[model samples]
Target: MKAQLELLSKYSGTAIEEIEVLFKDNPRLQSASVLGVNIFEELKTQINKSQVLKELIVYINDNYSVGDKLAPEREVAEILGYERSTIREYYPNLKLFGYLDIQHGKSTLFKRSFEHQIIELVKL
Candidate 1:
């Protein structure tokens, strides 16, 4: 467990002390660390540009409804055939880009405005 935390700390560029606190205090941070690492590694692999983004958009369109709750990362991963670690990598991006809004300890809410923006960006 210590080693995993250490790796997560290093991967996230966070101090070990801070990560320890997060491990105990905030489960989200732990999930974030693993997700961050997956995203970093995925970017490194040089897969086709926009592929993940496009796929994510499609997934969002297919699964989410405005004002509806999103499933947990584990369930989404099962549905998408992706690893939970990999699926999490996109969650924050969706939020950051205004595609989704997360409510702590509650399901994420879809933001419909992002649908068009994501489609436009993916086209380029």
Candidate 2:
């Protein structure tokens, strides 16, 4: 973990002190690392997930109209070049953000324009 942090510090052009300050500011992040999680990798994964989520939202907004039934998760995943599980994982987030209305058995429907919801998404 020390090595990973050092690599992060070097590549990110952030000093060790600044990294320590960030850890101090976010206790959960610090505790996660203490519990043996690779903090750098975890952070990288989260950043990547956020980027993918944004891409997915943009794709949906540009390609489909409100109330349109979306393709199945597998088909959407194939079209987006992501794993089916990845698309599935973001379904709840889409619903919560008012981008989609997902029903258990029925097809998912595009719920609203992404313009307003995108502001909230960036905070996530």
Q: Rate the local accuracy (lDDT) of all candidates.
A: 0.68, 0.71
The lDDT leader among the candidates is: 2
lDDT of 1 by residue, 44-109 (tens): 343235466566666777766777777787987887788888877777766764568887788778
List the candidates' TM-scores in order: 0.51, 0.54
- Model 1, C-alpha of 11: deviation from truth (Å): 37
Cα lDDT tens digits for candidate 2, 1-96: 466457547656888777777886776675555443344344335435687676677678778999899999999899889999988998887786
* Model 2 quality (TM-score): 0.54
Q: What is the RMSD of candidate 2?
A: 9.1
Instruction: Return the clash pairs for model 1, or none.
Output: none
Q: Score candidate 2 by lDDT.
A: 0.71
Stretches of candidate 2 above 4 Å error? 1-49, 116-124
